[model samples]
Target chain A: MSTTEMTVHAFTRMLERHGADASRWPERQAAERLVVRDAKARQLLEEARGLEDLLRASLPVPNPTAARMRADVRGRLSTGPSQQLIDWFDRGPLWRPLMAALLPLGLGFVLGLGFPEPAADDDLIAAVSLLAFDQGTYLDESLNASVEGGEYAP
Target chain B: MARVQARDSEALEHLMVRHGGALHSYLYRMNPNPSDVDELGQEAFLRVWQHAGRWRPERARFSTWLFRIGHNLCIDRHRKYRWIAPIKTDETVETAEPTSLRRAPDQAFEEEQRRQAVRRAVAELPERQRSALLLCQFHGMSNQQVADILEISLAAVESLLARARRALKEQLVQFINTDQATQ
Candidate 1:
């Protein structure tokens, strides 16, 4: 809107839109300057200015004892990694691939170490061989009888 | 930040000294609860340390990144504890005054009441509007900077600030009118 034609509502909108600082409102500065000359626009700007002042005054300053907060933050920063290690494992990109590769290997190693290979048990080997020998002899006898009968028939 | 990522405590300390106060104040303004403020501040800084490797200066300024951390923490905390007291009754604003000059009891009381009204008006704002107002108006950050921190467009930031200011003006119109009349 043109400066002379700007309404009070429009000026207020401009103030709210661009903020109270004229420098920041480059496009609206000329129009705002003109609007400021009008009584209604001036009143709106004044009220808006007052609100800005209150808003500024309302801001709580940095607590001086916030140094304690700084110290507390530092303390946590010192100890932060251990607590965050799990987070790192879960979210860290490198850790993800590293864990993905290492997990199965680590599990296999643990299982291998936890349960050692039993020393070669002669008794167990002998029992297995005896069973194998008996099955082999039974198969041999059946095959030989089938071969002899086939020879006689043929 | 690279040093922090490298696990340099001194670099982390330097960063904390530089930005911790501002971060704490931002959190306090957002929630005004001391415990929440402290916890969120610590959490934000902690995240900063943890995610130091993720920072890319080309993407955002360090302060913007840091404040984003704090802002996210505030959102998470607010979401988790919806029943926590709002920022309306924060007494920290009273202590924020200069202690060097003592005001009369009645004068201090009136000032406290005014501050309380302003806080309530601000705290009652919607999340984005409140955050926009806090970052832009109170923190003196540019609208573009606020947009970066809040991950909104410049127009959205301006709209948010505009709405927030308009709402604050409406809420405290009586006080603003009186103050102007007195002046």
Candidate 2:
């Protein structure tokens, strides 16, 4: 592309990047002057203006008075220490990290206290005794049945 | 902000007066419902009041920080409601009709139709793109400020805006051509 063509292309790209307003464009005063001088660039700028007009036209006019909104927000702000606590959490440097470090340890301590372990020796003895009793009962019953049927003569 | 952190109601009120209208306008654009806009605006400010102590000027400008709060509230409300609320275009059309009666009938009708079409197109844009466009165009924020508000990179903001403008132009191409032809 020729130098002029390249400049126009760059200007068009700038228009697309930053809407119709040449003032907001990074190239600033030079591009504004170019748009004024160059017919094609001016047309492109007009097209951008049209799009911006459409955008603005479509927007609803918002309520200007914020009295009600301000009152409501202020009411909420007047409440107790929750906001203070949140601010502390957000802005307090030492407390937050300290809490973060203590959270898991606190949770583990609570869980440990809630579910205490049973005595290991008592638990083992109960299981062994139960197993021995079941085995003896099974052997006695088998012998009695065999004797009654005379299957174990000796 | 320091005064607000110090619990000065006057400082808070001043900040509210300065920024409240823009915040409300932003929320209204995000959600066309007035009630929702009011609630969200209040919530955003309440947060600013609550978190005033946390405002670090080195991080962002006050407006950027405040808009971020409003944007997050809007996003939360959108997620909670799943954007079930319809855009309130009927009232706008009705209001526009009375004034347009004094103008040429055909031109007025076309203008109204184009306005509705543009509103619908904007409402249909992806949330991020819509936010980017609204912040950039309507709020007069720079792309960098939009990036900061949306918590995205500048390139992402630019891309969202490009896609948004492209979609809007495509949607309104016929209206645009007719408008230019008439001009």
Candidate 3:
């Protein structure tokens, strides 16, 4: 912990800080002297070296997955969360939501079939038909009148 | 980083390409599960993009801030989901077989076994210790950077690294001895 002074503890701290690479230690001369002169320091240096070598030898190489992950991350960022939500839906089978949205319509159809509809009044039906026939007659008259007139001919 | 803060996808992609491998390596060291590493790495970059506005350049380095997000994510996921799955330790050895190490089958196999042991030893370390060791050994992050990322004091980081390395040294002593002998 006392990294300020040139002590054995400080030497080990340096080992932890910079690994066992003596070339990287700030107090390289002092530390090397400790390693040369102190058995405990030497042992600590040995252990640190062993651990460092194991770690370096075993560390995974930076492979092409970085590019793959970068592309993936780029896709994620560009698409944003909403796009991702839509993509999630796209990934799932399509029918589920379609059925959900149609559920109300289907329910209405089923309910209409189950319940009897109120009958329309006869007078209302007669008025509707009469109104339709009059509109048809009015249209027939207008068309005949238009055909007779040269200005409105197609 | 400035460009990333400006909501630039290209800048974000550049950052990903630059730091993605180190992030993946750090995540792998924390949680050796392949799927989890990819998920965490992607999520880290995603957060960087999403939260870029919040980063104060004068306060901390971009790399430190990015790693802080990752460290918090890992901790939160662990707390919420009962931690990253224990490493299989099987795949890392194979994934890292150096091409230079291609030699006699028996020696290669022995080397593979040694690396596997090292991974197992690292996996068994306590959470903070493992993080410290991995961030240092994997990416060569200094104690200060590790402290910033882990939000621990430098002394705490030093203690964690010392303990973790000590444990690894003890566990993998045989391999280390053979390695030393070979040298």
Candidate 4:
């Protein structure tokens, strides 16, 4: 909206939201005019100006850390995968991470053994024969099956 | 931004040079602890580096996008460390009056008091109010940018700023009165 149409209340609200900086205000001319014509507007502007000044003085100066922050950022960026692992380790207590890692392993192990079925003697013999790379048991099993089917050849 | 998207350190550095001060300042305000400023600021840029490929320049200004990262980090950090006291130690105070204090001791001392009082006042503001004020006042981000960074509505940002300032005006009455008395 144009400055001419702006009221003291609107100007005051604008000052409150955007502060009293005429340059930053959208309706600088209107705000300036309001400040000139309206005494209350002038006072409000003055108060805001004072506040802005105090904030400018009191606000945290980022320059000190800005440079250091840049340097640290560059360093952080330059760090490779191995360094990131070390950095992760540096974040907090070791036991928490250790527990985080171990808890899942423990849970998985318990779940894996939760419903174990007893292996038959034949299954154990088969597993042992396979591990030993013996062809005798396999051949015997194949022959016995062929004989039972009455299809064995001498 | 394209080079940064390609994972170029030089371009990332360039962006940091351009917006690092404002970003650092925003984080410094958001974080109560001064020490976290470095780490948080670094993480903000690091995210820019890692996620530049995700940035859409047509959608938002880089600064807005960058501040949004910083804002999110601030919230997460705040939640992680909810009980942190806002410490305004003299050594941690980075304002200019410290150097000038050697020249005009009395005036500088008074300025220091006001500065600390203002810091205390700002620090004591609720998180969103302080965020709104810093983004708008110091960083020169528009209300929309503030809302975007804060992930709040424009009307909410306006409400936040008014509430923040009203609280400050109340808390700062003593300092204003002190100024008038001095003048």
Candidate 5:
């Protein structure tokens, strides 16, 4: 293990120093210095710099055609129901309708406590009523069966 | 939102015109496919439209927030599905028509090859490291701005970039050395 392995911080400082300005040569020069000091570290920084240069150089210098992008922006900006519809849908999964439904349910719950019970087709309440009837019938049958068996005839 | 809500078409257009190139370039570098770049760029703006009411002038600049949105969308898209392929010199460039700017034939060939190599190296880096490196080195964002965009501590941004740079160097060296050997 070489005692001279530059810490990550040191390498970062080198990047910050040299990479501060795109036009400035010092950042690259500083990076080059660090490369010289530590062979492995230098190797890495050089490769990174090469990659940076490739990016800077390869970037399509001539502005890319933005006709589509411009159309997109313009389409979005134009005052119309389309943007409004998109904005509503982008709110995700009928949030307003869900919220509206919840509000009535919540109001009903609050109203339920004070107002006379109104007749309504509640599946939950109907299921519970049917369950009670079935249980009563089951108990009656069990009692009859027990009497017939003389297990609890007395 | 600030003052540039839906009504701020001029402001929105100004923003798109000013920062669109850099933003497009960032997307292009991250994803080799031009379709993915445009798709993600459009998605990022869609977010801007949805959240227009939430933009705060005091906390961040509009462009800063916009880039942050872009940075997040790219990261999310990468995680959701791996769009970035291995960085290789031989990979074909797609999606973009060649720019009008002409270079000497040999120089253009060499430049294209180098770019493909760099792209592969960048794509191979760990996600955060690659994002941070691109934001700072390629997009010319400051460390502070990069940190803000990435929503990471400055130290974390620096660390990720360092690691990214190291990984790229290793890849570039191997690529160069192998090319030399073959020659």
Candidate 6:
């Protein structure tokens, strides 16, 4: 379409198609041409169009260090213990408390099973303390006084 | 347990493999500094791991949450470090590639220089204007998406983009002509 014949909307649409900015149309000329009604606007548009051309034609592409990035991330992730156990714990929400409690119990069980003599010693100590207490005698002052006064039978 | 935070290293790796490039690209475009981009992207993933347990399937999609994490990291870094540099055109890296043999060297070089100049001009603009341009031009995000990312009204995005384009034209006309003449 002839530039003179183009509507503002049409011009903007054209600019969009060309990947140009529509708002920067030269205001003077765009205003003068009431049909496009924005001569200055057109000029701004033209300039913006030129800049957009430069941007698109010349914009540099970034080549990210994908391999290096992966290695960096992998190295950081792998240095720690495998998350597999943690993940299993996470999946079973109810098992957390049980898992926590089992550690002490398991240790105790292993000690009992692994070395049996210490628990046996503890049992012997308990029996000896009980026997010592049972074999001891206590004097009864009230009984002795009654026997002395002859007020109590044998 | 949340699938991601279930602490599965293999799963974490898979997520990284799947989304790392795109996320990095988005963050890199938003923040001009390469160092900040690298750090922020990793930080975002770390946050994902930390908060994965709270992820509800019904609330949002994984990609959306991921993007939100990345976007938030960018904002936090912006506040902390004020990463104010404009998008830099690394022509050396761009033109050094033999695969890019498709374009004539002289023309490509001049064009790249022009773009670098324009990028600097855009950087000098107001934050809103620069943001609009980055979203629209560099990332090719739709206007609606740009608005969403910026947390502004669509009309506001349009206005910012408008002002941005005007400023760019006024600033880069001379550079554009010089580059074109060289070509």
Where model 4 places Cα greater than 4 Å from the true spot, the runs are A1-5, A65-71, A78-114, A117-154, B92-94, B97-108, B180-183
DockQ of 1: 0.23
Please give the CA lDDT of all the candidate structures. 0.77, 0.80, 0.76, 0.78, 0.65, 0.63
State the lDDT at B8 in candidate 4. Answer: 80
TM-score of 5: 0.59
Q: Provide the TM-score for each candidate, comma-separated.
A: 0.71, 0.74, 0.70, 0.76, 0.59, 0.54
DockQ of the candidate models in sequence = 0.23, 0.25, 0.19, 0.25, 0.15, 0.12
Q: Tens digit of lDDT per residue, candidate 2, span A31-145?
A: 7778778999888787778888778877765554588877877776676798757744543345475796899999999988897477887899999999999999999999999
Which tens-of-lDDT digit does each residue in B40-68 have in candidate 6?
A: 77766766776888777686556556766
RMSD to truth, every model: 10.0, 6.5, 15.0, 11.0, 9.5, 14.0
**How well is each residue in B49-167 modelled by candidate 2, as lDDT tens digits?**
77888999999999999999999878866765565455677553334335545667786677778878888888899999989999988899999999999999988888888788878
Query: Candidate 1 chain A: minimum summed lDDT over ten consecutive residues — where?
Result: A87-96
lDDT of 1 by residue, B61-162 (tens): 888999998998788667655754556554444554567787899977877788789888887899999898888666778888889999989999888888
Clashing pairs in 3: none
Q: Indicate the DockQ of the complex predicted as candidate 3.
A: 0.19
After superposition, the stretches of candidate 1 with alpha carbons farther than 4 Å from their true spots are A1-9, A62-66, A80-82, A85-154, B88-107
True contacts kept of 3: 0.45
Candidate 1 positional error at A123, Å: 38
1 or 4, greater by lDDT: 4
- Give the Cα error of residue B165 in candidate 6, in Å: 1.6
lDDT of 3 at B153: 97
> Model 5: clashing residue pairs?
A18-A27, A35-A42, B87-B120
Per-residue error for B89 in candidate 2, Å, reads: 1.5
What's the candidate order when arranged by decreasing lDDT? 2, 4, 1, 3, 5, 6
- Give, for candidate 3 chain B, the lowest lDDT window spanning 10 residues: B88-97
